[model samples]
Target: MRMRHVWMTAGTLFAGLGGHLQASDWNMPVGVTDVSREVYSLHMTIFWICVIIGVVVFGAMFYSLFRYRHSQGAKAAKFHEHTTVEVIWTALPLLILVGMAVPATATLKKMYDASDADLDVMVTGQQWRWHYSYLGEDVDFTSNLATPREQISGESEKGENYLLEVDEPLVLPVGKKVRLLLTADDVIHSWWVPELAVKQDAVPGFVNENWVRINEPGIYRGQCAELCGKDHGFMPVVVEAVEQEQFDTWLAERKAAAAQEAQGVDREWTMDELMERGEQVYGSICASCHQADGSGLPPAFPALAGNQALLDEPERHLDTVVNGVSGTAMPAFRTTLNPVEIAAVITYERNAWGNETGEVTQPADIADMLSE
Candidate 1:
């Protein structure tokens, strides 16, 4: 009765665990793409193959243990390895491995074939953000994590998306082969979107390519699969797949806005305007490292809030921002940011956090500095 109860308890425990796993979805998602589904199939096939092998091998061992027990007066028969048995075991495993490899190889071949893509997008990974340039579309933008600071600091309730949301998502047209040329600006990072079954490394000074075609129109989110830096966990990738018409419309709107922004490159701006725009730019680009409050997490990221050097030397600050300090995490913003953006962010940094520099560096000033 005790043995039976023990068995019953073990069975109950396994049953409960199985139920919990099922509820929590302890399995890869059946993604909405052909390659994703194929990958899922491959994963399940290998898993089931392992399960079957385990069951057969363990079943025979357990049966032998029970049947050959000394308590039952069974004599142990010691024998050397039989050639036939050895050959059978080895051949079976080899055949199983070959079978698994064939499909995996085919899937890999399909993944590598990024030819005849409908669109090409250059994806550049920074310390904690993604810069996307739509090749042949005249659209470019930096996608940053949009999750509020309060939620991240545990001061406010987390949203449904939480760390998975971004200010600007990579938008793609459904049923189109979108090829991504991945590279990094500073360190090695990974561009991963599981629903599309595309995960490629973004290494500095080198480019890697991957393609994906979304079968459905929806929002899919992922994170940086590689550890880049302190804020690696904060970088998220959001993809919004839409119809071709909708995608074209979005592209047109983006191009129009880009043109309008370019017009302001030579125009002078007020301090209030610079500060307002700078606040937005700073939050998106600078906040991840120096923090939202300018009280940086040193000794890596130095505090920008009350730095005496920054308050005193305005030209030095501009030079540093344009041409970053060597052997540090600071990246040169000359190519990344336009004159207006650089001016605004510089002004904001000097004036914000009660430093009260009362500086209003304009785009013309930045342009002049760039020329020299």
Candidate 2:
């Protein structure tokens, strides 16, 4: 009779939680990949096992406390050396663990095998941005958070994808095994996209490999799972998976754009043109440190507004940006940015805010300096 009562109480407890457990938003998403689905299955399997165990334990405790109260003259009953009960308790948990481990091990093995990938992407983590390079494709770009400052500051209403949106999303094709080689340029960071079931640490000087083959065409969003810097929350990852034909067209267009940018290095640039491009590049890359108003956070990032000394030496400004100061937090942008970007940003900084130098620094001059 007691055993039946305990079981009934356990069932009731578990039934109360069933509704929440079935909620899609409450549980792990059955993601857009085969591996992700397997992971979700494993998660639910273990979760239910844990829920059952908790229900049984708590229900028995509650039943005993109510039915065997001291006021009712109920005495504590103790027993020992019962091999049947001992074996049931011991073997039950062991069997459950083993059952959970089997599927988990299989999924982990599949996740680790990143060989013979159709596409290889080198994902580099920086201060608060992600730089993705399509190996052998001669295409690489940085992805920065695209959420407006107004939205963040509570001055304007937030958009649907406020913090998760980016200026450039890492584009990939569905039905292709795209292997990611992740590493950090500075501190340790993690590239995590839950839908793809790929979470790998991006450690400096160490390459971690993970692969994903999206089964759907959609935009998947994620963020850096590691505490990288002050702007850690600002760093977001967006992947747009499209059809093979669409991906091919996008890649070709990117290639053509890159070639055109290379050609720009040999031509003379106008002040207006440089300022426009420079303002954009500055906003994405330099605005974080130097600030949008050119008033940098001093002691670390010195002010760039109304700084006559820096504005006077155009050559020093160029070299400082290219090579970077050895003992400073500023990393060199020579490799990170192209000649056109470099010249345009420098021109923009010199002319922006209260420091209008009116100098037209051509991409050709920046390219020549880089070659030397």
Candidate 3:
């Protein structure tokens, strides 16, 4: 009984370790994988089978080697061929292979069935962020790492989420099939979430699709599975899977916000109001690479104070913010930010600092441009 308990303990430890032993670092996740668990079971099955075979084969070979040694005065047999032994060895391997292949083929079939999804979301990988668009809905947003640079640099206490937090989490209704369309803007990236059993490449100028149907409603987190750029590790993917009713409520709220934005454009606001609202929006959206004080990280993120691109030419400023300067790190804010937001940000930049143009751009102007 004591020996049996010891074996049980050992077996439990081995099973627990098996889950995380492969990539036992923060590099690759280990909680659960779509095909990995199946693969692991297949591995263990084949491994034990091999162990049994190895023991039998080696036991016979060693027994013959020791018992038939010439030093023991054993007579050498004249017969050179053993058809029975050769046939047994060949047939045994073939049977073992067939056994392994059966389960493997089943798992492969399940992994490849990426159709008939209930929900479809397009996941576009940018240089240092992820943009998600809910198909058949006007809900779309970019998710960025919310972790501060100070914490990342070890200058402060890292939050609970740390490098795994995002400003916006991809929301989904639980127990529903979700199809993800993956692609990249500049380079190759990979979208991976272990719990949901998703990992697909975000290739540039190309689209790949993967599907998942989460069993539970919870927050699932993952990082950029592929190396994107300088801030590759900073790009994290967070998913909030909520109940159907809760998801509907969230969707309704988003639509209301969109409607509010449409009404806000035509209505005029005081400079004080725009500045106040713009400050918050800019801090959340633009303060990562660009410093909070309008003094951006030099060389890479140029300061907006004396920027010719933003100050000298208003057309350039509007164009760059809306359409984005292609082939660069500056992603277009048109889709991410509403007209009122865009106008407020543009106004804040123009009027702020000594570059005082005293020009106020109403949201209506931005809306008109977007229409064009």
Alpha-carbon local distance difference test for all models: 0.91, 0.91, 0.81
Q: What's model 1's lDDT at 200?
A: 94
The runs of at least 3 residues in candidate 3 whose Cα sits more than 4 Å from the true structure, single-residue gaps closed, are 1-102, 352-355
Using all chains and alpha carbons, the TM-scores for the candidates as numbered come to 0.92, 0.92, 0.77
What is the C-alpha lDDT profile of model 2 across 88-149, one tens digit per residue? 99999899889889989999999999999999999999988999999999999999999988
lDDT of 3 at 313: 92
lDDT of 1: 0.91
lDDT of candidate 3 at residue 176, scale 0 to 100: 81
lDDT for each residue of candidate 3 in 1-372, tens digit (9 for 90 to 100) = 998998799788867766655566632332333454665566667776886788688989998999999999999889988999899989989998998899989977877777898889999998678999988888787788888878987999999999999888999887787788999877899998766657789998998987776666788998889987777888899999898899999988988877787788899878877777777677666776666778888887878876767777999988988888777778788877888889888888877766588778888888898988
Return the candidate ranking by lDDT, descending.
Answer: 2, 1, 3
Evaluation by lDDT, superior candidate among 1 and 3? 1
- State the displacement of the C-alpha of residue 199, model 2, in Å, after optimal TM-score superposition: 1.9
The worst-scoring run of ten residues by lDDT in candidate 1 lies at 17-26
Which lDDT tens digits does candidate 1 get at residues 288-344? 889889999899888999999999999889988999989999998887787889999
